[model samples]
Target chain A: MANMIDLIEKSEVTGDFPKFQIGDTLRVFFKIKEGDKERVQVFEGVLIGERGGSNKRAITVRKISFSHGVERMFPLASPRIEKIEIAQTGYVRRAKLYYLRDLRGKKARIRERQDYKKGKDLSTAQVNAAK
Target chain B: MTMGIMATKLGMTQIFIEEGVRVPVTVLKMDPNFVVSKKTMEKDGYTALQLGFGQIRAKLVNKPTKGHFQKANVEPTRFLSEFRVDEKELANYEIGAQIGLEFFEGVLSLDIAGVSKGKGFAGVMKRHNFAGFPASHGTHETFRHGGSIGMRAQPGKVLKGKRMAGHMGDELVTMKNLRVIRIMAEENLILVRGAVPGSKGKVVEIKVSTRKPKALPGVGGATLEEASKNPMKASKAGAKGAGGKKK
Candidate 1:
């Protein structure tokens, strides 16, 4: 399993991905191609969960549209992703913010995480950081 | 036309093509291989080329294997495999001549042959996929049994090669017509679509298919030419000054 991750990391492309966490709100700029044309589509949502490591890493984003909850899972290393903007950071106890799905309106709101600002933005640095 | 090479199964991964289509591929590391011997119809009653792959330590080479490599003036290899090729193409190859992933260039589909992972001693249900007896309702200890072997009194013993519990896997399995998704020639790595017949690190013999790849249009000679044109030249050039190995 670890070897699989190592193999993935070797092939995964590392771009300037934004630093965000579960329960945080993000605007993911995804590249969508149309008939002989390509455009960037912005998907704003609350980060529900994140799984896998390095190249195989993926994030689940959930957003409410017309009172209906919609969730989309995006691979972090996918080339279709143009950029990700961390609009707001949310304070979360659990790694996966799946419980947010059940809550509506006021209850769904996540507290803003203040501690994240104190640390230097690590994701911005182009260094070989492995987890 | 019998184009094949010996490679080690590096593992499996997914590559995103145009339009975010994730193609699952098994990466095979094709170590440098050399033609050890060629069997001609006049000499050996067959037209085949015996290729040696992976470097083996001189001490690890047996007496017979050492003699074989000595005769060819090449280093001992870990694995030796034979593939049938056309007699006319046999002249293109020479004794001790090297081959690698280059042979697989433009090969859209390939036949992967390897020893599947051994599943030890298994029962009929797991090994043969036999639907066992009911789990509940007085079916005690007969849960995983193969049930009735044959009709009453008709044939006393079990039929030969009957699907029964025994050793499973650890056998030579060939997965044919797998699409060749990517070829990293610098690393000697080949990415083939779909699952191969072996576990990670297993030695797999990859050969060009005589049959056409299913449903894939324009997968003939042109694809192989495109693959040979060094698609990864830009990527390899970027890493040259860093003193890093491609693999």
Candidate 2:
């Protein structure tokens, strides 16, 4: 009886999603279609949290623009999302970084996490100093 | 009263179409449907086709219904619905004729009717959508009350059909003009763009919309012609195999 729902759920699976979590810096490339013309727009921000599951999973991205904090939540499985790039690794203690909204300037910064991968944004001295 | 079929609401989900737009669709699973009997003007003084759907065991069949199935020379089914058609269209169907999901192919929209979800013993706000008294301004226990029902002497008692709190839902509800998003004939599944009348797992009656859409390209320009054609006069393949391109 429920096989039809399972068939639709199977078709909606894109099958290509990288393991990126909350507190990770993300560069999302979204495809913008304006009538006949189409373009890719990039939004660089920190992924504060994620909710839902399966095809409905969404990412909440927060970025400080012009000294004003802006947060955008969108479905990660959206067809319009062209690419998702992890720009930085953040070490945090909580699942949702909503407390970052109350902090400002240097206080809003996320502590860098030293995972196995090398990041282009990290300096050689900074990487060695963490060791 | 037009051409219709019986299907059950499977559930709702989203699917990506050609334009990368995710359309919300309700999955409806219609197993093979058959024409059980025909009511004619000469016999019943009305024109309608009794369609039988859903698989049922022969042992579970009662005596009368089992006899009715035996007369039609078809297997027993659990559900039957009558679709009114013109007397002239009565000649199109014979008992034991098979109607497939392809019957809805090329149709742009449809109307569905079913029993809605039951809300037992609901309040006025939940039932009749009555605007209750203000919560503040020293309001007491009547926040969600039915409010004043009648005036004093002029009307004496409350007028008939006055909106009041009572049994809510579990009544026949029809949702009209739901867009036909896609039809998966292979799977016997039709994806409708919007919500149907009932919640999931409810048997719903699907009929051709009363309102005709503007400029929908019907396959072979045939709905009635194709449907009335003897199953052998045309290939039994689905709509895709037909000479018409998929819309």
Candidate 3:
């Protein structure tokens, strides 16, 4: 039998998004509604963390603005999100890039994954796809 | 009052509605809820509907339980509960009629009652939210104590119903004015906005809230919490007259 909670959450997930890991840089196109007009805003940042489950999945993105760190969280299943484009793939030892908040300038750079083209991170990609 | 239904707590999850706002919702699975019997004002001195839910095998039921289902001509149910209703409202239901999720259609809020998770033999700090003695101070084992129970002399018998340590939780608790987020009739599920008392699979009583039904937190206007925080805004919102006393 299908899990009732899963069935209910599945109804809210309307889009098919490509898999991206924590260290990857993501370019998010979010819809902003102002008065009677709606416009798309682009936010490019490194994926810091991911949380929640099923249709409630969310991602934390971190970027430097005016030399100050700014982080924003977005629900992956939200309809307001136009699309999430994978800007660049990276390799990191930890699941969260929260430690990068303390580092600045050249020290905060992420190492690009050499085998990203080959999809060597297929294992984590498969797990996220299942969710 | 309207009739209440019985449902199982299916834990909690979040959903993103319009505008990308996230709402934490509790999923309640309502099985086939049948009207087992009715109590009339003339016979039982009060009007109420006895509801039965959660089907169980006949062999598992005792003789009296089996006979009760036999009297109603309904299948054996694992749980039976009563929802007191106004004398006039009692006319809406008949014995053995099944109540579905549609009953909550257009309802804004609800009152959910269930047994809260038990925390055996808890101290005042844990049970009553009492601040314990400072750990750095000379306080020893009395950290979790309830402190002074009574005065030195006058009327000093540890006054009745004083806050003290005892059994905590595992009792019938009613959470009122819980916003009704979404209702899925096809799946027999009602998604309530916020937490419901009890652990997953615990049986709960669901009914319309007795409180003056305010405009659900963020359906259209400002949320109740936000309104209360700004009296100037609340008064302005009050002029629009969203919620009124339950008549």
Model 2 error, position A127 (Å): 17
Best by lDDT: 3
What is the TM-score of chain A, computed separately for every candidate? 0.79, 0.80, 0.86
| Candidate 2 lDDT tens digits, A1-101 | 78657655555555355466678788888888887899998899999999977666789999999989999986765767888777776777899999999
Q: How do the residues B33-65 of candidate 2 rate in per-residue lDDT, one tens digit apiece? A: 889999999899999999999887888899999
Local accuracy of candidate 3 as per-residue lDDT tens digits, B141-218: 777777888997798588898898899999999999887666665556777878999999989999887665455334
Task: Give the Å shift of residue B76 in candidate 1.
Answer: 1.7
Off by over 4 Å in 2: A116-131, B212-247
* lDDT by residue (tens digit), candidate 1, A59-127: 999999999999999898776898887777677788888788789999999887663445532332221
- How much lDDT does each candidate structure score? 0.74, 0.74, 0.77
Worst 10 residues of 3 chain B by lDDT: B238-247
**Runs off by more than 4 Å, candidate 3:** A116-131, B214-247
Report lDDT (Cα) of residue A72, candidate 1. 91
- Which lDDT tens digits does candidate 1 get at residues B86-176? 9999989999999976687456678989999999999998898999999899998999999877766767777877888899999999998
What is the iRMS for every candidate structure?
5.9, 7.0, 10.5
Worst 10 residues of 1 chain A by lDDT: A122-131
| Candidate 1, residue A86: how far the Cα is off, in Å | 1.1
Q: Highest DockQ: which candidate?
A: 1
